[model samples]
Target: MSSSSAEVLLVRTGAAATLDRTSVGGRGTVASALVKTPRLGAVSVGELGFQGDVQADLEVHGGPAKAVLVYSDEHYDDWVAELGRDLRGTGLGENLRIRGLTERDVCPGDRIAVGSALFRVSAPRRPCYKLALAHGIRDLSARVQRSGRTGFYLAVDRPGEVRAGDRIAIIEHAPHRISAFEVNRVINLDKRDVDGARRVLTAAADLPPRWVAKLRRRVDGAVESDASDTARLYGTD
Candidate 1:
């Protein structure tokens, strides 16, 4: 597939596993292994998530709104340069390592098809403490958010099979043009931009409820800073 034509560069799935307590902010012995195993061929995609994939914490991760986490192959080089290491095969806790589409190109509510499975872009993936735990980097989550290189989540619209080489085509573009990159920036970095927050919360009808709640808090002056609730929910702290 052409670079402009979105494609699944890799298909990955994780087993139910635990985290070690030694990692910073580790949720000792939890039942999730966000790190995924790259599948060699086709794999089934479901509404909850990919086959064999399990999320440790449901309060923050793994739901209909975030059934499939997607990361761009485009960001791998940047991550290597920044972290001074290779991150391939890490899955980045994402079900699909994709090419062609980045946060800037996709928006909430956009519909896409990968092989036979269909998905709707639900929201941007909020980097939490789990990210730091997964990579053994103390400040990776903050760095990812600041760089606006965070990936996105996809809500499964139609269950089917997806392979590594499957073409990911945009079947429907969202009417609202608020990209996932903008959403991440507004929520994680620019909490003071009341106008921007209002635009995202009001214009993006399909924005995830948790994000909507957070943005509403920001718009209403309920939150005084950029401290997010994700750490509390996932026990990243």
Candidate 2:
């Protein structure tokens, strides 16, 4: 698939239930699988999420701006090599597994048409301990953060049915032109990049509020401790 026309490789959904493992701190039950089950055919995309999908924790997962989670199939090889295992069943808790698009190629507010639904890139997926728990690798979340391959979230603009093999056609690219990868790099990898943080913060309306707030503090030269915030954002608290 070309950059302009990516294809949905798979569709997945999961129920809201108790996680098989405890939180990273081992203090409480982290009520999320972060592992979606594949769907064989077309599925309805609603304003919040897929028809059968349910987030274990709404505080961090699903919402209007985070209606859907998207990951590229292009990253599978890298992850396979990094993890040294097959990730066929591990959907990374993403709703759509697509091809051709990655963090570097997609930007906040970019619009796309998938099947009959319309979606806009909202923000980058912040790596969390749930990823490590899902993959059985204690450092996977940190590795993902460093790699900048952390996928992205999409806000549903028009609800419709979508399926595997559906072409994802670009509708409108955001004027700001800040790729999700750049935002992740500034926030997670290089907090000292004040200029980059400023650009990201300016696009506040297109990013997650939590990220916008954090970036605001960084750009303002305030000492913002994100360790606890990150943990809370991922519901590992």
Candidate 3:
């Protein structure tokens, strides 16, 4: 393992709310909890998420495998340079804004201890329309995916409380599995990487079933059409 240490820079949470068409350009009203704001001091964490945190779409979000969203502050500078704005704070809707850890550092199944709670690296986040709507950029979701700065999700292993400045120590690292960055690279960015997909599937037994199934499909030669991929990647509007 590298000498880099993971540390929490911020903790954020928010409830789901309805958005009108005007707010989403012309895509009609929708419900989303993507507008996360920093939470002062320690915050309670559970199997689902932080105490007040809510996800509008349980079908795609807010489950055990995706209990918490984590973003690396290491990417914020690049985001600001790309978006031409101050992209700090909870603009990315991550429950934990962390430093010294990125997709390349953690692999699926790695156990992490943060504050009083423990978590496992589950999967790399797949950006959707909510991100685009939040930033008012039509293709920002796709851009994020292609850029490989898509952050990641975590499953609560031992629920407790977390606070800013908490050290994120990896207690158990899954050396056999590919890092989250490699997953995103082969599956999202380099779509033609069949051998890479196979390698991921071979070692990613700890990933969610849906994610495993998705990779299995790709490796088995059942790739989705570009139109379908676009819809899944960006969502409506």
Candidate 4:
């Protein structure tokens, strides 16, 4: 299949900074790089991520497999409509916002070339409360998952420079044909989807190992894992 004519709308990077907030639902100080600034020109891409980009929580956020986070600019309209507010400069903490492709259009393990960098689609982002905190929406993280607008992560295969307006083209497609949407659906929305879980496992070699283990256990009929600490992770009362 031909690659979609995806164009990067923005390239953003940020360092970890302190955000102090007090609200009816919550109050605290947190270190986050969720607030990103647009990079005006080409930026270096490395095995970890774009130059100057940093994740506050390395435990859950950044790693070799999640070097870059890509969001679909296409979802912004839906979000604006749902939130009933102006989000003109809000990035929702994404590294690259691009058009012409969404979760359904990309599959795990697919190799994509954007600018001079080569990347492999990794997995759907499992959003948490920092996203909600960033947007001041208590349920925004949950909304992102349930809406199937969960942007994806990219593992840099060949480190190079990237910048705004770079063309995104898939150089190789995953053999399994399972889109990132289906993977997120199986894991977050359709936990009972045994068949879907099996299909996801077919692409295990190309997916994040943590997700692979989760699916493997599901396929083996193992007991469901411990529930996520939603209150802690989502900052909801």
Give one digit per residue, the lDDT tens place, for model 2 in 48-124: 98998888877767888888999988787898898788665765778899998888988899998999999999888
> Root-mean-square deviation of each candidate, in angstroms?
2.6, 2.3, 1.9, 2.0
By TM-score, how accurate is candidate 3?
0.92
- The TM-score of predicted model 2 comes to 0.90
lDDT of 3 by residue, 104-139 (tens): 998889999999999999889988767776767767
Which scores greater on TM-score, model 3 or model 4? 4
Q: Write the per-residue lDDT of candidate 4 for residues 74-149, one digit (tens) a residue.
A: 7988888998865547677889988888899899999999999999999888877777777677787888888989
Minimum summed lDDT over a 10-residue window in model 1 is located at 228-237
> What is the C-alpha local distance difference test score of candidate 4?
0.84
How high is the CA lDDT of each candidate model? 0.80, 0.81, 0.83, 0.84
lDDT of 4 at 195: 90
Name the 10 consecutive residues with the lowest summed lDDT in model 4: 223-232
Error of 2 at 117 (Å): 0.5
Clashing pairs counted in every model: 0, 0, 0, 0
